[model samples]
Structures are given as structure tokens and as C-alpha cells.
Target chain A: MRRLKALIKKEFHQIVRDPSSVMIAFILPLILLFLFGYGVSLDANRIDIGIVMQDNSPQVQSLIRAFENTSFLNAQVERDRREIEKQLVAGKLRGMVVIPTDFTRRLINPDDTAKLQVIADGSEPNTANFVQNYIRQTWVNWLLQSGLSEAMLTVDERVSIQPRFWFNPELESSHFLLSGSIAIIMTLIGTLLTSLVISREWERGTMEAMMATPVNIIEIILGKLIPYFVLGMSSMVICTIISIVVFGVPFRGSFITLAAVSAIFLITALQQGLLISTVAKNQFLASQMAFISGFLPAFILSGFVFEIKSMPAFVQAITYIVPAKYFVSCLQTLFLAGDIYSVIIPNVIGIMILGSVLFIVITRKTRKRLI
Target chain B: MLNRIKNLVIKEFLAIWRDKKSRVILIVPPMLQLFIFSFAATLEVKNVPIAVFNRDTGRESWELVQRFEGSPYFTDIHYIYSDKAVKEYINSQKALMVIQINDDFSSRINSGQQAEIQLILDGRKTNVSQILAGYVNGIIDRYNRDIKPEAQVRRSSQNAIRKGKLTASPFLSPASRSEIVPRNWFNENLDYIWFTVPGIVGILTMLISLIITSLSVAREREFGTFDQLLVSPLESTEILIGKTVPAFIIGMLEGTFFIIAGIVFFNLPHEGSFLHLYFGMSVFLLAIIGIGLLISSVSKTQQQAILGAFAFMTPTIILSGYATPIENMPLWLQEFTVINPLKHFLIIIKGVLLKNVPFDVVLEHTIPIAVFAVISLSVSTRMFKQRLE
Candidate 1:
């Protein structure tokens, strides 16, 4: 017990003495929070759309008014058609809504149908799709309300669908993205600190002296882990506070549940780092391994940025091994849905299983003897 | 003097080339990550799981179900037997949305009344929900148009109602039916791989330069060989060359290999001038090597340098417009990205590859990158000199 305590104190002293750990622990979270919160956004709002209305009809003007009212679109009037296409290629205009010259003439005559042309810059399909849908919806609503068609025989009542969203009614992406950021941040801190710890000992020639001591491998591993585990936890706390307070992402789940799940995930992340450090005693290899094993998987495979189900089947199968996948699932559900047992329980179990497997592997990889 | 610098560069190259692990580290990981991340890192949403709860037994409802099943966008659709199944599927996250057809769907449509369909989406994945709703709406809109034909329109209201039992809407006149013609320009199919593969070239080049150059001096310092190099008869300029040249060459080679792979294997379009492409890459490598040298000089350990590189990476990627569009970012953030060399390189490469832009267009983006390269080179050489002293 005393040896473990002495080793842990030594680890703490090392961490406090190293400015890099301190910088990574505190400063990195702030940078990431600011970046994820303000810098990154998936919301396709305020898209620039050009309107070419060759007709001067009141109905056409009303249709244009519908496009202007929505917060998603910024409707601009361009007199020339050639200029609009140039602007689209230049990435200035996302879409163009052209109201034809014969629009009012067709509306007056029962047999003649009018055509509205919507040309979207398909270079960016996402924005193009959004522009098409919003314009189509607006036009359909206008058609429904125009009351230009005479009523036919039979009942007028029809079936209508009422859509009710369960959680996150406004569908704000920031709320979920901030939650997933916590997983990425923890993965970064956990792998970075632990990999540095073991490899720094090797680089500075302190491992020979440390191994000469009476302490066992488990004592050393535990000592190395406790400080970084605390560091990782503190980093998590900092990120969580920033997410809730600074980003205004509601913390719907209990703090205890959040801490518990984070602890399991941090264990897996730390063990993964320790395994890299043990396998590659040099700091360069260790850090590179940490990045390849830790940051990439956590960021890409964890479903933080990309949806797992949307990926190809082979890629989806691979995401099963990524520990951050479980943590992100738990964190997002916790933040948005407030501790639904079904999600939290299964995700926690998955993380616990990964952590245990990683722990066994780290123990097998760690050794006291110096070559 | 030239021979001395050449020997120093050879020594640096041998240090990486002689070690099998270093060779693998230098070459393999970038290629592997490129292949993996290019396939993985995508914002394009496809194969979203949805559940269908059809209470109607009509032909129209069955055809609607068939239409949804046929779409490549929607996949793994579960047909729920009861309301309990709907709640369970959503709660367990098996379904992103549920398309519920009411019992009177067929009756209403058959009797010339509009039938309503309910789309209940699990809003937790908000981005997916929004896009899924758009996809569903698109399917329904197309279906709505198919029921009404342009060729069979008549002026007599009775004959129109009789002929178009389900098609004729009280509010929608046959003549005034407007067709919205949507044309997607450069990327007609909107394949995301074509977009991201070119971006991988910019990212992988930055990674190689940043990691190699940052590690060069830091590795020497960690092994206590930095002082040996300093005490040698080699000039400071030669020392800088020894550190920057090999890594710069490797970075450029890797970048060129990636571009070729993208064009040949991935079918990525290369519309811009090859001369401009190489020019942009050289300037980009210069800036990255400068940043790497600065990091190596400042960091006392290999660990610190790697961490510092990571610190630069997060912001560079976020600001680079690689994953997300720069225009979507706030005005202040967009302004901040002006200093990010990765952002400039991304614009240059992506514009060249995808946009088929001319030299003037390419030069506009490359100029800023060249400025960054100049600043980084001068500052990093100054820092390298300081470190040696």
C-alpha cells in the first residue's frame, strides 16, 4: 500500500512538473469546446438562393414571398439568368427559383398547367437537396391555399399526418455534438497522457532505475494510471461544464451516471494507451501509435461526426471494436434523453466489456524487467 | 561545403530508412488512414433505418410502401404490427423514423379525398431526421404527381373528376400544375468519395510534414544527439537543410502518390493544370515544414512535439473546410481560418480537382499559402538558430 502511494505521489509530481500535461489537460479542452461549439456546424441555415421571376403576377410575387419568409433561405433577385449560373459555379448562389412568364396565364385557364423551374447547384448535393425540398414545400402550400380550382364531387375531408418529435424538438445539432465532443476529448487526454508517461520514463532512462526498485509491475501500472485517470476525469469535468454552461447543451442525465460511464470508458482508453507505450518504448512511436489507435478511431468510428448505420456494412462491423462508439452513444443519450435505462445499460455493458478486455491485455503486455 | 550538406541529408535519410519500423511509420500509416478515413469520414447520409406501420390495406398504400422500399436512401425498414412495436423500435434506436399510414388511407383516396400519412422521426439524431424527412417528402411528392397526368386534362369538371378519381384535387387545377425542374450542376450524382478523396491529399500531406519535421529535432534532443550535431563542423544552414529537406521530399512524394491514386483508382477528376497542382503542393509543404521545425525547436521532448502537432491539427482540421463548409461557420471563425494553411490548401486542391478552375483561380488561393510559407520559413529558421545556440 505504501509503495503504491509513494509511486502515485511520484506520478502526480511528474504530471505537475510537466507543462505539456498541464497544457493538454486544461488548454486543450477549452480549445476543443470553442472549436466544436462555435466553429463546427451542420445546420444548413441562411442558404443563398437566387430568384428569377420573369413574370410580374401577384401570385408569383406571393410564391416568392414564401421563400423569403423562411429562416433557412436568403432569397435574392437576379435580373439576368446568365449571371445566376456564374454565381452558382462560383459557390455564391445555392439554388435558383425561376417563375415563368406564363405562370398567371396558366393559373387563369383550367386546362393549362404552369411550370416552375428550380435549378440547384448540385456541386454540393446537401444544400441542393435542402433548397429543392423547401421550395417544393412552399409551392405546394401556396397551391393548397390559392383556392383557384373549382370543387369536385365527393367529401373534402382527408387524412393528415401530425409529426411529433420525442426529444430535442427543435433538432438542434449542437446539443448532441457537444455531448459527443466529451468522448473525443477524453480519448485524446487519456491516450496522450498515458503514452507519454511510460515512454517518457524510457526516454529519460528512469525506467531502469524504477525497475531496479522493489515494486512490482501492477504497482507501477496502477501508479501510472491513477494520476492520468484523475487527469482524464478532470478533463471530462471541464468539458462537461463547458458543454452545459458555455454551449448551453442541457445535461439531462444524472451526474453520477455520467461519471460512472466515463470512468469505464477512460479505463479502456488508458489501457489502450499503456499497451501502445509498452509495445513501443520510444516516445515517437508511442505518440504515433496513440494517435493512430486513439484519436482517429474515437473521432471517425465513434459515430460522433458520422452516423454508423449510414456507413457501409463492413465499416459498420468495424465500428463495433471502437470503444468510443459505446461512450458516444451513452453520452448522447444521457445528454439528450435523460438516462433512459435501455440505452445507458447496454452502452455501459459494452464499455465495461471493452475495458476489461483492454485491462487484461495491458497487464499481459506490461513487464518489470528492462531489456 | 555542398558535399558536407549532402552528407548531413544522407545521414538523416539513413536514420529513417535503415530502421524498418521508421520506414513503415513514414510510408504505410498515411496510405492506410487515407483508405480507411476516405471511406469512413462522410457527411452523406445513406441507408437510414425506418419502420413502417401500415394500418391501411389499399393498393395506393402498398404502392407507397413499395416506393419507400425501392429507394436506396432508406434501408432496414421494419414493419411494426402494433403501437407497442413502434415505441420499442424507437426507444431501442432500431428506427430513425416511423412511417404510419392511417386506416382510412385507401378509403379517402378512393373516394376523391386526400389521405394523410404520419412521419414520426426520432429526433435525437437531428441531422438524420431532417434529411430523412426531406427524403420521405420527396418520395410522397413524386407519388402525388404520378397520380395526376398532364396528357389527360379536360375543361369539363365532371369528366375530369370521373377520369381522375384519385388524381383530381379540389384545389389543384390541371392547367396550373407547376413542375419544379431541379438540376444539380458539377456533381450530378453527388458522390461524396469524389469530394473527400481530394481533401485526403491535403490532409495526408500536412500530417507527413508536421509529424516528420516536428520529430526530427525533437528526436535528436531526446536521444542527446542534438548537441553532437551542433558541435560538428556542419554549418547552421546545413543543419536546417538536414532537418527540412528529407521530410519535405517525403511529404511531397506521399502527396503526389495520393493524388495519383485518387485520380487513377478513385476516378477523381483532375481538371486544373498539373503545374499549378505541384506548385500549390510545394508551397503547402513549405508552410507545414516551417511549422514543424518551429514545434521541434520549442519542444524539449518528442512527446511535447507530438502533442503540439496534435494541438495544431485539431484547429487546422476544424478551420480547414475539409469536413464542413467554411461558409457555414460564423463570420469570426471564417476570418480566423485565413491564417490556416490547411484551409488554403484544401481550397486549392478541391477547386482544382473538382471545379476545373483556371490558373488565375488557382493562383488566388495559392498566393495566401505562399505568404504563409514565407512567414513560417523565416520564423522557423530563426527559431532553429536560437535553439542551436
Candidate 2:
């Protein structure tokens, strides 16, 4: 027990003395939280749309004015069609609404259709679709206000679908992204820092010296694990505070559940790091392996940025192996929706099972002999 | 001085080449990331599982259900009996959306009365929900048009005219619909892969260069071999050149591999001059290498360097308009990205590749990148000189 205490104290000393580990543990969360909160947004609003109106009649002008009134569109009137095309190609204009020369004539006569051409820059299909939809919606309102669609409005004979979005009503992406960022940040803090410390000891020949002592493998593993476990949990707390307080992402689940699930995730992540360092025995290789195995999979396959269900069958199967996948599911549910036992239980169990398997493998790899 | 720089470059090259594992890592990961990320990082949603609570047994309602079944976007159309079943499926996430058709759907259509259908979507994934709603709206709109009294009358007239039973109608319809013809420029088909390839090239180049150069001097410092290079007759400039050239070469090599992969496999359009693309890429490399060198000179260990690089990388990549547009970011954040070399490079590379942009237009984007490269290189060289003292 005395030896274990001494080793724990030594590990704490190493962590505190090394400014990089301390910075990564505490400061990285600040940068990551701020970046995820403010920098990344998927919403496409205030789209710049160029308008080329050939007719100056009040009817044509009113339609253009209706477009300018909407919050989603910013309408800029350019006389020259070529100038508007230049803006579209340069990405300055997302789309163009060309009011034809005979727009007012056709509207007045009611015999000919008044066609409004909406040309969208399809390089980015997402934005293109949004622009097209917004334009059509604006046109619909104009038609109703003008009394042109009175007959159609009176018919009102169709299916009415009420769309109720269950968990996130407003569909604010920050809620889920903030929770997902916690998983990513915790994974980085646990895996990258742990791998670096162990591999640094190996590179500096300190591991060999430690192996000659009476300290056993379990003691060494615990001594290393305990400090980083605390570090990882501290980061999780910081992230939770930032997410709830700064980003305004609601924390719906119980704190006990969040803590338990986070502990399991951190354990799996740290053990994965320990296994990498033990196998590589080199700082560079360990860090690289940790990054490729830890960061990329956590970023990509964890369903943080990409949906696992949308992936191909083989890729979806591959995502089952990524520990962050289960953590992401648990964290998102915990942050956005309250304690749903079905989701939390399965994901937490997955993390626990993966963590235990990792713990056993690392234990087997960590003998009293130096690699 | 030139010869000393040359010899040092050779030394740097040999140092990396001596390690077989390191050599393989340098070559393999970039290629692997290219394929994996290109394939995986997609915004296109497909095979969305939706439950349909179709209470109506009429032909029109069945046709509506068949419409969803025929779409590539919608799949796994499970027919549930009750509202409870739909709720259960959605709550369990077995169905992302539930289409509830009212019993009077077909009857109301036949009687020309109003009918309603309810679409319950799991809004947890808002982006997907939004797109799914759009698809549903299109299907319902087409169905409404098919059953429209005016459209059916027009079809009968058109058939009579086709059979030469009547001349063209002298009277024009008063309620003729105005069509909104949408033309998507540059990328007519809106292929996500084509949009991704050029931006991927820029991002991959920046990452590879930053990692290699950031670790180069830091590795020597950690192993206490940096002092050996400092004590030698090599000038600080020579050492910087020796360190950065290898990273620059590796970055350019990776950029070339991406270009080839993008063209051969992804069919990425090369609309502008290759010379301009290479020039823009090299300047971009210079900017990132300088950032890496600055990180290396500041950190005493490779670990700190790696962390520093990671810190710089996360925001840069996020802000680079690679995954999301820069214009969508808040005004202050958008202004802040003026200094981001990656953002500038993405614009230049993507514009040149996809837009058939002229040289002057590409150069307009290139100017800021060049300015940033100069600033970063000069600052890093000054820092390296200070560290040597």
C-alpha cells in the first residue's frame, strides 16, 4: 500500500510538472468547447439571391418586394443578366430570380403563365435545395396575398400532416454537437495523453528502471490509470459546464448516470492508449497509432459527424467496435433527453464490456519485464 | 551556404527513410484517409426507414405508399396498424419518420373534400428530418397534381389532339401555372463526391505537412540532437530549409496523390490550368509548414508539438469551409478566418478545379495565401533563430 501510494504521488508529480499534459487536460476543453459551440453550424439562412427584373410594373415590383421581406433571403437587384451570372459563378450569389420581361403582361391577362425562373448554384446541393424551397415558399405567399390562388386556397382538399419533432423541437444542432464534442474531447484527453506519457517513459529508459523495482504490473497500471482517470473526469466536468452554461445545451439526464457512463468511457479510452504504448514502445509510433486509432475513428465512425445508419453495411459493422459510438449515444441522450433507461442501459453496458476487455488485454500486455 | 543546405536536406531525407515503418506510415495513412473519408464523409441521406400507418385501403392511398417505396431515399417502409405502433417505432429509432394516413384520405379525394395525413419525424437528427420533410412534400405535391381536375381535363384534350380528333384550342386557360425552372451551375447533378475531392486535397495537404514538420525539430530536441545540428557549421536558415523542404516535398507528394485519386477514381473536374493549381498548392504548403515549424521551435518535446498542432488543426479545418461554408459562420468568426491559409487554399483549389476560373481569378485567391505564407515563414525563421541563441 505504501509503495502504491508513492507511485500514485509520483504519477501526479509527473502530470503536474509536465505543462503539456496539464494544458491538454484543462485548456484543450476550453478551445474545443468554444470551437464546437460557435464555429460549426449546419443551418443555411440569409441566402444571397440576385434578382434580375426586366419589367418595372407594380405587380412585378411587389413580387420582388415580397422576396426581400423574407428573413431567409437577401435580394440584390442587378440590371444586367451577365453581371448576375458572374456573381452566381463566383459564389457571391447563391441563386438568381429572373422576373421575365412579360411577367406583368402575363399576370394581368391571366391567359399566359407568368414564369419566374429560379437558377441555383448547384455546386453545393444542400444550399441549392434550401434556396429553391425558400423562393417557392415566398412565391406561394405572394400568390395568396395577390388573390390569384383564391380558388386553389378554397379547395383545401388534401392530407394534413402534422410533423412533431420529438427530442429536439427546434432542431438546434448545437445541443447534440456539444454533447458529441464531449465524447471527442474526452477521447483525446484520455488516449493521447496516456499514450504519450507511457511511451515517453519507454523512450527515456525509465520504464526499464521501474521494472527492476518491487513494483508489480498491476500497481504500475493503477498508478498510471488513476491520475488520468481524474484528469479525464475533470475535462468531462468542464465540458459539461461549458455545454450547459455557455452553449445553452440542456442537461436533461441525471448527473449520476452521466458520471458513471463517462467513467466507463474514460477507462476504455485510457486502456486503449496503454495497449498502444505497450505494443509500440516508441513515443512517435505510439502517438501516431493513438491518433489513427483514437482520433479518426472517434471523429468519423462514432456517429458524431456522420450517421452510422447512413453508412454502408460493412462500415456500419465497423462502427460497433468504436467505443466512442456507445458514448456518443449515451452522452447525446443524457444531454438532450432525460434518463431513458433503454438507451442509457444498453450503451453503458457496451462501454463497460469494451472497457473490461481492454483492461484485461492491457493487464496481460503489462508484464514485469520491459518490452 | 547552398551546398550546406543541400547536404542537410539529404540528411533529413535519410533520417526518415532509414525507418521502414515510418516510411510506410508516411505513404499509407494519407491514401487510406483519402478513400475512407471520401466515402464516409457524405451529406447524402439514403435508405431512411419510415413507418406508414395507412388506414385508408383506397387506390390513391396505396399509390401514395407506393411512391415512397419507389424512391431511392426511402426504404424499409414498415406498415404499422395503430398510432401506438408508430410511436414505439419512432421512440426506439427503428423508424426515423411515421406517415399516418387518415381513414378518409381516398374518400375525401373522391368527393373533392379535404383530407389530412400526419408525418411524425424524430427531430433529434434535424438535418435528416428537414431533408425527409422536403422529400415527403414533393411526393404529396405530385400526388395532388395527378388528381387535379384541371390537369385531368388538359390531359383528355391533349389525348384528343394527339389522335387528330380536334384542332388546337383557340381559348387559352386563365389558370395556367407559372413554372420555376431551376438550373444548377458548375455542378449540374450536385454530386457530393465532386464537391468533396478538391476540399479534401487542401485539407489532407495541410494536415500531412503540419504533422511532419511540427514533429521534425521537436523530435530532435526531445532526443537532444537539436544541439548537435545547432553546433554544426549549418546556419539557422540552412537548418530551417533542411527541415521544411522534406515536409514540403511530402505535402506536395500527398497533394499529387489526392489529385490523381480525385481525377481517376472520383472524376474530379480539372477546369483550370494545372500550373496554377500546383503553384497555389506549393504556397499553401509553405504557410502550413511555417505554422508547423513555429510549433516545433516553441515546444521542447514532440508531444507538445503534436498537441499544439492538434489545437491549431481543429479550428482551421472546421473554419476552412471544407465541411461547412465560411459565410454561414458568424460575422466575427468569418472575419477571423481571413488569416486562415487553409480557407484561402480551399477557395483557390475548389474554384480552379470546378469553376473553369481564369488565372486572374485564381490569383486573386492566391494573393492572400502568399501573404500568409510569407508572414508565417518569416515569423517562424525568427523564432528558430531566437531558439538557437
lDDT of 1 at A54: 83
| TM-scores for candidates 1 onward, in order | 0.90, 0.93
Candidate 2 lDDT, A1-371, residue by residue in tens: 88888998999998888899988999988998888777777777599999998888988888889999999999999778988888787777889999889888876654567888889877776687788899988987787676555434433345555777777888888788778889989889888999999988898999888889999877888888898999899989988998898888988899999998999899999999888888877777777778777887887788776777777777778778889999998888788777877778888888888888887777666743444
User: Distance (Å) between predicted and true CA of B357, model 1?
Assistant: 0.7
State in Å the error of residue B194, model 1: 1.0
Measured with C-alpha atoms, the lDDT of residue B245 in candidate 2 is 93
* lDDT of model 1, residue B342: 90
lDDT of 1: 0.80
Error of 1 at B313 (Å): 0.8
Reference-based lDDT, each prediction: 0.80, 0.81
Q: What is the lDDT of residue A192 in candidate 2?
A: 90
Chain A superposition TM-score per model? 0.90, 0.93
Question: At residue A116, what lDDT does model 2 achieve?
Answer: 86
Model 2, C-alpha of B337: deviation from truth (Å):
1.6
B1-389: candidate 1 lDDT, tens digit per residue: 88888898899889878877778787778787777778887888888789999999988799889999999897688899789988887777788899999888888776656788988877678888877877787677566656543322233344545655324443454325666667666666777787778777898889888998998899998888989998999888889888888988888889889999898878888776888888888888998998898888889888789888989988998888777677678888888888998987886787677776667666777888889889888998898787677
